[model samples]
Target: MLGAIIGDIVGSRFEFNNHRSKAFDLFTDNCRITDDTIMTLAVASAIMEAEEQLESAAEIGDNNREYYRLVEVLAVKTMQNLGRSYPNYGYGDRFAQWLSSDQPKPYNSFGNGAAMRISPAGFAAKTETEARILSEVITRVSHNHPEGLKGAEATVMAIYMARNGADKQAIRDRINGYFYTLDFTIDGIRDTYRFNETCQETVPQAITAFLESTSFEDAIRTAISVGGDSDTLAAITGAIAEAYYGIPENIKEKALTYLDTNLQAIYEAWQEFKKKRSMNITFRPAKLQEREILFREGYREWPKNRTFEEYCSDNAKEDEYGIRYIMAIDDEILSSVILLELKSIMGKKVYGIGSVLTPQNHTGKGYATTLLRKCLQQIENNDPLIFLYSDINPAFYQRLSFRILPLEFQKVKKSTCMVRCRDENWEALLKSSVALIPDYF
Candidate 1:
């Protein structure tokens, strides 16, 4: 959601001027939020309202048909309400007309607006099927054209897969199989691409921009460099990029400033709504029946030339050190981490977190992050120090307030060692402690 807003603001100045190069400054005074941001927020608002209403309806009776019907109705109402509030936000001719119509109906449009505003559905949905259902419900209120529906569904699915930890190849393959045949590259088409507003022309290029990008900023730059419906292109690309590579804190902070009071409130409310939803997630030690699945998954990370039974036996031995903590909903394990107790150093209790893994099917739902946060809350007050050897990007743990320890404090050969301290004098504590490296998990 913020990703789309950031892209919309950054690309607003270039939408008409067409700066077909990546060397331009990202944010400027001329940059402004447009229809993209408005509709994105509107869609998000409608979804939240619909979900709240659905919960209420579920308490009374089972009415899936009526619940979805309400979603479509609220989508139209919210978009019109917000669109009318921002009358001069550069909405397209047909969309502007639809907004003003008291009895607005689908205009059979296949515009890029459908794809640009569809990202919130991806984030709100729990499964690919729900993602498609949400996309179709919200989009059909305005962009009922088949191509428009396809474009929106494709974008939503890309976000769903990216958030779920699908690799680039998997996303590309799925898009190719169902949505668009991404045979062209950003570099191949940059010189020839022109201003276009249709979804068929816009979505594939935006997706390619994200595919070729190495960072969130790079995705925005690459989308603008294509020189076609710049804001919409970048908004589409930015949504996917944010799902894959989180927006840096600096970028997210700057982007929020562009929103006015009402929009800012909506964004804040959405954050709170999401947080409340995640509160239902529970974390605990892995159950006896679940250890085998954990072992099988862990073996993929560290096979050690051992048979399945040998790997299970070896993992069982680690129970003396620590137990596996799992994040789950109902009976499904979403993510797991090994919590190891290490020998106390300098009279401070030390704990090691390792084998942080989310099953491939559940990568992007933020289960691991929630699990880690729960783990920290469970231990931080009781222990003075906590440590982890990160096998993946250290930035992930950094976001959780872990600092990379100096090389002298590292015990492993190639892994990055990081620590979280409950005390303010942890640096001095580290420097004064004896040269005793703790055992690696």
Candidate 2:
């Protein structure tokens, strides 16, 4: 939601003094990321944290609503926590009260605050119904009014539609069919519009700004020029605009400068979470029926002298978890794979990473690095000395913290044996003569 945050910062200076025109500096020294930006990030953080918890939960039992309930709790608590840290960042009166209260309860108000921070709900949810539910969860914590909930749901649904490749007419039809009327244009509202905080008065105006604009910056300018609750209006408009136009890189970089460390950390974490979530890749072992496809794909990466049947016979076997850890896209197509072999050398556990392969198409996208990180984390818990033989690309493994053993200590002459061992385990692993697997190398 960089678009929404950029809009918030750009419009922050014009929130009170009505601009009434689009011709103005987008970024000024006076502009700052306000409650809209903080609370939007807070919503994203809460949703991500709730998702992680849901994934970690051993059992959902029978109550599927438990997932939404957990998200609701996190949304409310995280908003309050972040709000306290950014106490001076222009919160609405009712929201400010809710944030400070020991037993915080939602005030039945249809404030624009609900719509301004609901962008994350749109991005995180997989379906329209899920987006609606998440928006309601985030909105009702402070703005519990029906109009407030409607505004939040409509904003999120618009973003979800745009993100999923819906046209502007579809977004307009959906928003108008569900929540506020988009009967007015940004130009029509500019001269006469006054500062308004209620969702009914503000949400429609914000939608019109996005509907009439040609670019993301144009959308923010259109929202701000209307001169009614400028920051929140632009935030709501920019959320939709971002999904449609994709904010410019320079604008995103400039907007990030306005955020404090706390907000920046949450934004970065949310970005990383979104990136991983969007990969649509899974790590698993080859099934009995798909063994041939796996072998064919593996052969494409490393076309050695071995036949496909021989490759299948070799990698078809499994480790303790019965997984060869193939990183596959769409379950049938293999993008990368890592063969794991664990052994006991000199009374110490040792893990060997071998047969690391990523097809030509997926070579530079860090899929190998992703697998390496996952394998390293799994090994670190058991305190094993990890080693890998990278004959094809030693530099790639070296970049991932695998260090080459000294020439005097090297047992393999054809390939480099790089090891990643803890400082304490380094001396012990080096002292053992049997730790090096010459055949595997």
Alpha-carbon lDDT, every model: 0.84, 0.77
TM-score of 2: 0.64
Candidate 1 residues lying further than 4 Å off, grouped into runs, are 56-63, 280-326, 329-441
Off by more than 4 A, model 2: 56-63, 281-328, 332-441
What's the distance in Å from true for residue 250, model 1? Answer: 1.2
Backbone clash count for every predicted candidate, in the order shown: 2, 0
Give a tens-digit lDDT track for model 1, residues 253-300: 999999999999989988887786666567789998999898888898
Candidate 2 residue 145 C-alpha distance from true site, Å = 0.7
Per-model TM-score, in order, reads 0.68, 0.64
Instruction: Give lDDT tens digits, candidate 2, residues 109-215.
Output: 89889999999988876555577788887788878999999888888988876775555654676677668778878777677889999898988888889988989
Q: Which residue pairs come into collision in candidate 2?
A: none
